[model samples]
Target: MLAAIAAVAALIVIGLIIGFVRGRKKQGLPQEPPPPPPEALREDRPKITVDAEPEPTQPLQLEDLVPRPPEAPAAEARVTPPPAPPADLGAFRSGLKSTRGNLISRLAGVFRPGRELDTSILDEVEEVLITADVGVHTAGRILEALRTQMNGGQLSSVDDAWGAIREEARNILASGGQGLAIDQTPTVILVVGVNGVGKTTTIGKLASRFDRQGKTLLLGAGDTFRAAAVTQLEVWGRRVGCEVVKGKDRADPGSVIFDAIEKAKDDGIDIVIADTAGRLHTKVPLMDELKKLGRTVEKALGRPADHVLLVLDATTGQNAIQQAQLFKDALPLSGIVLTKLDGTAKGGVILGIVDQHKVPIEFIGVGEKVEDLKPFSADAFLEALFESPDALDPSEEAATAS
Candidate 1:
């Protein structure tokens, strides 16, 4: 009975083991991780890529390895300086040839190798001075100084006489006051003169000088009576790159100048140069007209014109003194512009003008050239006037000799 019972238990255990194995098969458990999804196993599936580097067609050169310079600009875009113009006239010595020759020759003629100095010698010198247009007053003063020197035994030779005269000229020139007072902004310059005294040319040259100084300038064509005058001033304005304020033909000059000053004030110009009609000082009506213009300038500027420059022809000689005196009486003539000095032997008239009227010579026109119109330098004028031919440059000496 024990043996039979044992056999049945064994059978039950075996049946239990087989039933467990069959239950696992029905669930279908994977043996490893099961093969990947069928879609992932296809040949066209996305894959990671690692590309090889590209090879150059040719070997590199040293220049190719180095960075290249930037390309040059085109020909049309290039900038070049303009060619130079004709040379300018330089030095006062050359310009004073005529005056120097005339005065120096006459003075030199008086001093021969053995000419004795006497009272009659004084008379001859005085005559030469007067003939040179040194006014009676200036010549008298120069002679008086020489006589005092001679009495004091200071003048021993003709050389002493020459020295005395030179000293007197130096004193007279030094007495003239300082140069143009450009102390104010928009320095108003009123240029007045009789007809044909080079007023237009002087104004043009002045504009050139101011332009070179880099100052902003305005020109007033106050000579509205003459259409040519306005046109000429416009030409100068264009050349100097300055603006010109003008009015209709025969417009009131005072109105034109007033407008110019107003414009200059509005534009903040550095200078205002006004051109006045050429009117004779002897004419009462004309003189009154200038006086009215002066009033207009003062009203517009809130002050008197900075410079009332009287332009006179140096060739007018003593007549220039009369003109200067009359103009001084009519207006506050601050300075004088002596033109055509190179064309005349009467440059000595400068001495006379200074003696008669204390107005300083502002500028002197020694030639027709713009550069020839230079600021008056007393020392330079005397030096050039009395400079011996030997002391001058070859060109100046040649000019004087001629």
Candidate 2:
């Protein structure tokens, strides 16, 4: 039994020793450490780093940005202006050339530079006045006034004599207002004249004047004796922008005037300028016809004509004064319109007409131009005649001092 037990102990000890060697071999061999947590493995991976300071960048050019639209071309710059006309006084001076040359120049000769104030000077002045168509009676009156001044010691020098004559002329020419008296509404102006005295032309000019004054005007072609008269008046009416009442050729002028008056009343016209047949003042039959026409006007309108304007040719000289007298007898003439004043040296006839007939001179035709028919002003007329230096010719200066 002892032997068997000892043998089992030896076997056990050998087994034990082998197991210890196997255990030592397993422990001593190189072994990996336990895998680290997932976080620790990620931390060990390679990482990228950035520099704190950066380099500067280049600036952008105009071509790099969006382009702008081109501008439109600029426009050029400029300025402009109107016209002018001749002055009234200049026209008047030109128009008076004929009369001033003929009459006033001759009158200037009467006042000789060294001549004494004597009756001889008065004689020369009287001749000058008479030669200018001033009429013998009017010339005599002027001479008488001048002689009285000379005798009163008022005249001493040539200038004094001229001044005396000027005063005398102004005194004779002093009158009521030369303007037409249109006190009543729809004032009727009966324009009467013999043939070829510019009645129609005067009417046209008067119409233009009234139009410029802002007056409503109506023209009546009462010159029924002439066929062309109606058409002529109509032309003027259209030119002046006024209405015209016309009759047939040789139609009753009174009838035409009656129609005009009625039309003026209806249309609220301010004036009615009636053209009449040109008649010889000496023709009794024509004069009677004029009277009948006046009666017709009064009968139709229930009032007499507002004004009777007798137109006369200044070139007719003394004949115009006779015509004025005859017309005054047949029809009451309120005023005279002296036509062709620029054409005639006998513009002095105005003084005779006013002196003999006591009719106021209303207007004077200085030229054929529309604006040449001027309202007669005694002062302006005398000033234009006497005050103009150019009125006296150089040759006449020697004659004046002779």
Candidate 3:
């Protein structure tokens, strides 16, 4: 067994040596070459030199870094528009529509197309003027002027006759076309009228007119005989941004006016429009009261009332003239405020009142609007009354003709 073990061990050793030799031969046999170095492994490897320094970079500015949008153009200056002219004349013309038809149209008929100026035509003209509430004296004066023009060989054609009449009427109204002279500070205007003659409304409208003119105004509700008069004045005061100085029921009008003037003086008011009891012109007690009220206003201001505007109802015709005369006799009236002029065909009463009383017609209440109480202009009045279609501009004439 020992011998078999030795021989087996020898064979095992020879086999192990042979196996080792075979492994060695296999290892020694040529294999695939080892991979190249890491630098040489890349196909696009760059050649690098170690001597050169890198270039410096610049910092970016706000204007250069990103793309910018284009600039916008400068703005242009703005223009202002012009102011509008006053429309009082146009309003006056519109208000005189009735008068124009009643008086002007009748006069125009007398001087129809080619009618010659004759005494008969003059008589008819006098009748028309009188019928239109132009008082007998005023009509006669106008007729005398017309007859004088005729005697002087000036009134030949119907146009001449119309021109003469207009000239005479204009001359009569021109003197009384003066506006209320409100030159004083806190100008006092004591408005007096008969009952039912729109006395309060006239005061309201007048206040509105003065307010629109940028004048600081105060109203005096001196007509304490009527409670509505006080409230009405208050309403107007609010409407026109004026303060109203009122009295108790049936308070003395003069005392109310005195308080109003004192208040106006204190408040730096530009005007004080005082209302008075609307009394009958012929009523002695009431007229004396108005005279006392006027004196009170004078006493308060240390001067006569700047204006004693007699508010007359134009629709009353010649009765208006009579009323105005009575009021003139009672109070020192500066001017007249003709109300309801739009309601009357007897607007010719304006001519009569001015011609007879010699008192200026300061304002005419043409319509119910506040602005309708226009500052009286004789030229505007005459133009509105007598401006024929032939007086229109060519463009307007063409339009009319068409």
Score every model by TM-score.
0.74, 0.74, 0.74
Q: On residues 148-214, what C-alpha lDDT tens digit does candidate 1 reach at each position?
A: 9988889888877887888998888775646666667789999998878888889987877777766
If the candidates were sorted by their lDDT against the true structure, best first, what order would they fall in?
A: 3, 1, 2
- Which candidate has the highest lDDT of all? 3
For residues 80-124, write the lDDT of model 2, one tens digit per residue.
Answer: 111113234554555566667666887766775677767888778
- Poorest 10 consecutive residues of model 2 by lDDT? 75-84
Once model 3 is optimally superposed onto the true structure by TM-score, how far is the C-alpha of residue 121 displaced, in angstroms? 1.0
Give the local distance difference test score of model 1. 0.78
Q: Each model's C-alpha lDDT? A: 0.78, 0.78, 0.80
Candidate 3 TM-score over all chains jointly: 0.74
lDDT preference between candidates 2 and 3, better one: 3
Off by over 4 Å in 3: 1-87, 389-402
Predicted structure 2, TM vs. truth = 0.74
Deviation (Å) of 248 in candidate 2? 2.1
List candidate 1 segments past 4 Å from native: 1-90, 389-402
* Superposed Cα deviation of residue 30, candidate 3 (Å): 99
